[model samples]
Target: MKKSIIVSTLILSSSLTFAFDLSAIAKNVVENVTKEQTTTQETSTSNLSDTTVSNGLKEALKTGVNYAVTQLGSNNGYLNNTAVKIPLPDNLAKAETLIRSIGGDKMADNLINSMNTAASKAAPKTAEVFVEAIDKMTLTDAQAILSGGNDAATNYFKANTSDSLKKLITPIIQETMKENQVASYYDTANNLYKSNVKGLVDNSGVMGLAKNFGVDSFIPGSSDESLDEYITTKAIDGLFTMIGQKEAAIRANPLEQTSSILKEVFGK
Candidate 1:
């Protein structure tokens, strides 16, 4: 009986090992297949004509850029997308925290809402600027971006167009802020905070001490970012961030390419 039991145990162990080996072998096969598919996809783009590639890139950019602008320019666009929502400037954010702690939620909320509203209003102006940039994209730029990483085009835009975008966006943000009553909201919030004890902290020697001790960097009201500059910077950044995502998506999935040119250049 003992000898029989030993033989059964050996058989069971071998069976379990075989099953495990099969599972490992299957995983390796899947990994190899995935690698081969990726390689093929990369090599597939090598034969495209110069014009086809350039037009494909331009079409992709137009689609991605328009989508981003439309999404962000709509009502409550920035307000809804937490990923790209504009927030209080760093220093003012500290003030917001204090305002909330002292039952000033209404005013604090208004300021936050108005800031995002201003960003949404200012978003559409970017479409024109982006279209101009895309039109000016060089064939060489297209080829490099196709062969380079996913965010290469976005990086190109950043390097080439950021300054122009900021210039265009700043005035629009200023106008939007006026239309949205962002400053009015801020003024009302500031009044509420001033009525609270936390407001006194800003005037007292405490702020002076913090400034001298290198704590001012962490203190509210210490940052020099005017509301206009803050909103403009964040707005442009948000647009580009969304555009980069769209570019990456199109690059990863050929199905994301919506045009005939894109499909032809990127391949099936």
Candidate 2:
């Protein structure tokens, strides 16, 4: 009976030891898994810190600028694109109608074509301005852009680079306008209106008759801004529009990230 009791006690002790061993093994496995998970998380977080995030943002901007410039600098970029097509200024539309009425439709068409051509020519110069703006992007600026809405980067570029872009692009636009004969066309159209319609409105015997007929109102007198200014402004606006689209695209699709840093930082 005593041997029977001893055997039973030994069996109980062995079962208890086996259960303890199993419990320890399970605890070790859980602890190991948790440590490994924590390590992975910390590594991922370290890779996407402020500096990396800032670099990723800059890379995204650079990629966007390059894409926008390539698309806009090609043949018929501005001329073919209805969205960014340079139309006659509102003040000049009336003049165009009157000129067309007087068998000067070709002249009006020429003016419109020349304006778009100038915008296309000057569009290529915007990349240099964009690069300058990107170079000026601060870490804080990048963080803000990343956290902000889709157009945040685009708005930043506009606010920061508008004045500099104007200075850089205006001369190119002016030169393009001259090369494309925009000024000459404007001058010819202005003279034709003055000769044919100016006298009729002046002698119509009605006060403010010029305004009523929309004749002299369309022709800008001396000291007024030239067509080049309008074209430059519109071209700049179009460039930003394209850049904004690119920015939104990158924000939406992680696959659009071109660089490793971009993938890591934005993939999160």
Candidate 3:
């Protein structure tokens, strides 16, 4: 009897110890599972928030760019628009008159039309490139652009899109100039330049024929590269200038009858 009781006690003690170990293991497993779930939830939330902020920035930029391009592409977008209208360059007036007087009136008019058309056509595309840049913006950048001046956003667009804009506008300008028979106008211009230089040389006894043809250097500190560069650059600048104007207006007073999405996005 004593031996059997001792054997029973040992069996009970072993069972209790085994049960305690299983309970401890189950508690640890439950705790680990809960921690993993919490971490996954936090990570998903963070990623979603980042995506929202990024997309928001892109939308704002797209809106601004579209508004600007639309204004510029419209009739008299550059010529009538006060914010970015390109004025006639003084040096080209005499050249234009000489060409017109020399029976190149049609060619000169075509050249003007070509320049204007190119400006209008190329103005709208700037927004497309700017929208791409906006995608790269962070939340902080979006906030900064929104709060910045009318030209601040435009300046930013220029900063990002200048190289691409040049690549695009240069070809378009070249094409327009050719299609409008710019070569004919240039010939007239060259003749006028030569005549003027010849008269000046006759009076002053100084040879400037090379300078007239751009074969020799001009007077010291008299560079015209900036003037030529402005032809296209001004058009691009005007495009963004109009956009910045519209953007500012939208931000300040907003539209009365905006689209549902616009209301949803900008109404806030």
Candidate 4:
């Protein structure tokens, strides 16, 4: 009877010890898990601090702006690029058609070429404006742009620099157009049409002839858009479009991360 009691006591003691060990193990496991979670959270928060985010966004914008300027500020940049090619304005379309139909196609072509040339000449000036605008970007703006969609940076620049860009680009365009004699060509064409052609064609008779020939009729002095204004507006729009493309490329391609900050922020 004493042996049985002693054996029972040992067995009960062993059971209590085992239960205590299991409780301690469970407590250790919970503590370890909590620590790991806290460390991970801290690391994530540290990685995306305000300065990092802001700098990363600014770097991306600078890359985009520089790439766009390099691509568009070269010879034949606007003339060869169909996407941003400055065609005759809509108001001048009829004038171009008229000139073309009368074997003055070279003159019309010259006008179009001059417009594109002026835009190309004015493109280099944009880099200065873009850099200035980028320098003025606030941290809040950077955060908003980084969290926004692919074109967010481009949109931000457009919104902030539109007025400044217009003011900066307009005079350059005007100077280039003047050098190219864009206004002179248009005025010459208008004067020629008015002096030599208008008296020869009866308006109703010409309309009838145009209807019979299934060709759109033409008129001169109808275009309200000034050449300088049209070229300046189109040039700025094209630059923005190019910048947007660059921004998207950087956002989507890890290889485009040119700097350490970009690699850290956008590499994800």
In candidate 2, what are the lDDT values of residues 1-268, reduced to their tens digit? 9999999999999999999999999999999999999999778867676878888888888888887788777887877888778887766775576778889787777777777777777777788888888888899888899899987987898898888878888887777677656466675656665566556645775427666675555554432445767777888888887888888788779778767887787766
Model 1: per-residue Cα lDDT over 123-164, one tens digit each: 888888888888898999888987888778788889877888
**What lDDT does each candidate get?**
0.79, 0.78, 0.63, 0.80
lDDT for residue 84 in candidate 1, whole number 0-100 = 93
**Better candidate number, 1 or 3, judged by TM-score:** 1
Q: List residue ranges in candidate 2 displaced over 4 A.
A: 1-47, 95-98, 101-103, 180-182, 185-224
Off by over 4 Å in 4: 1-46, 94-98, 187-213, 217-221
- TM-score, one value per model: 0.72, 0.68, 0.57, 0.72
Query: Candidate 4's C-alpha lDDT?
Result: 0.80
TM-score, prediction 3: 0.57
* Residue-level error in angstroms, candidate 4, position 38: 17
Worst 10 residues of 3 by lDDT: 219-228
- Tell me how far the alpha carbon of residue 102 in candidate 1 is from the true structure, in angstroms, after superposition: 1.0
Best candidate, TM-score: 1
Error of 3 at 173 (Å): 1.2
lDDT of 4 at 176: 72
Q: CA shift at 185, candidate 4, in angstroms? A: 3.8
